[model samples]
Target: MYQLKTKETENSVIEFIENVEQPKKREDAYRLLDIFSETTGYPAKMWGPSIIGFGSYHYKYATGHEGDAPLVGFSPRKAKISLYFATGDTAREALLEQLGKHTAGKGCVYINKVADINEDILKELIQQSVQFLKETYPAEE
Candidate 1:
């Protein structure tokens, strides 16, 4: 019975941003909060102690592990910011190609700062990720 640790919390997103060690990262956190909220049509919520997530969806794996996760989220880490998105989205690779200076992991896009990436491309990635999750999981009404 493995439990997901990143469930949404009622903690303040504003306070989280304000506590960021770097001033620039704090500013970028606010900027991203606006971007993700506007794009996902959902208000920001704290995921665990760090991640600022917008929307959420429940996913059940083939192994029967199930958990709810954010549709799109970002964390301002000490080294770089981590952008979380759906894994195996068919359009993701193409969008990442157009995205400027960012490094990719299985499901996280790491960026040095807000200025290092193109805003339009980031929005597209957010939209695509949200769409893919909605289509794949189809949240219960």
Candidate 2:
């Protein structure tokens, strides 16, 4: 069976953010922590070694590959800040256009800093991602 590398851990999110090498990235991480926490109404959690994630959801693919992942998250990397959002949301593209400055991958949006992007747009992305995931993959109760 294949295993997922990124799993929720009991690590300290504050300690992780404080240890961020760059001063700017560290500050941005804190800001993101506040934004994501307030927006998602979920506490910040250490997902794997680096990602600071909000709410979580479980996803199963047609290939039988499934795992629980954060509905929204971000990582302040050395080069750029990576924002994690739902990959299947079509509305993301439209919002990204209005988002000040950023580069996006399949599931991650890279930004130079928090100031470089629109905070409102970021919040919308977070909310949309969370809603999309919840609707797409409801909790198995």
Model 1 lDDT tens row, 1-141: 677889999999999999999999999988999899988899999999999998889998899999999999999999999999888977999999989999999989999999999999999999999999999999788
Clashing pairs in 1: none
Q: Which ten residues in a row have the lowest lDDT in candidate 2?
A: 87-96
Native-to-model Cα distance after best TM-score fit, residue 12 in candidate 2, in Å: 0.4
For all predicted structures, in order, the TM-scores are 0.97, 0.98
Q: Candidate 2 has which clashing residue pairs, if any?
A: none
Give the Cα lDDT of each candidate.
0.93, 0.92
Which residue runs of candidate 1 sit more than 4 Å off their true CA positions? Answer: none
Q: Which structure among the candidates has the greatest TM-score?
A: 2
lDDT of 2 by residue, 27-59 (tens): 999999999999999999999999999889999
What are the per-model numbers of colliding residue pairs? Answer: 0, 0
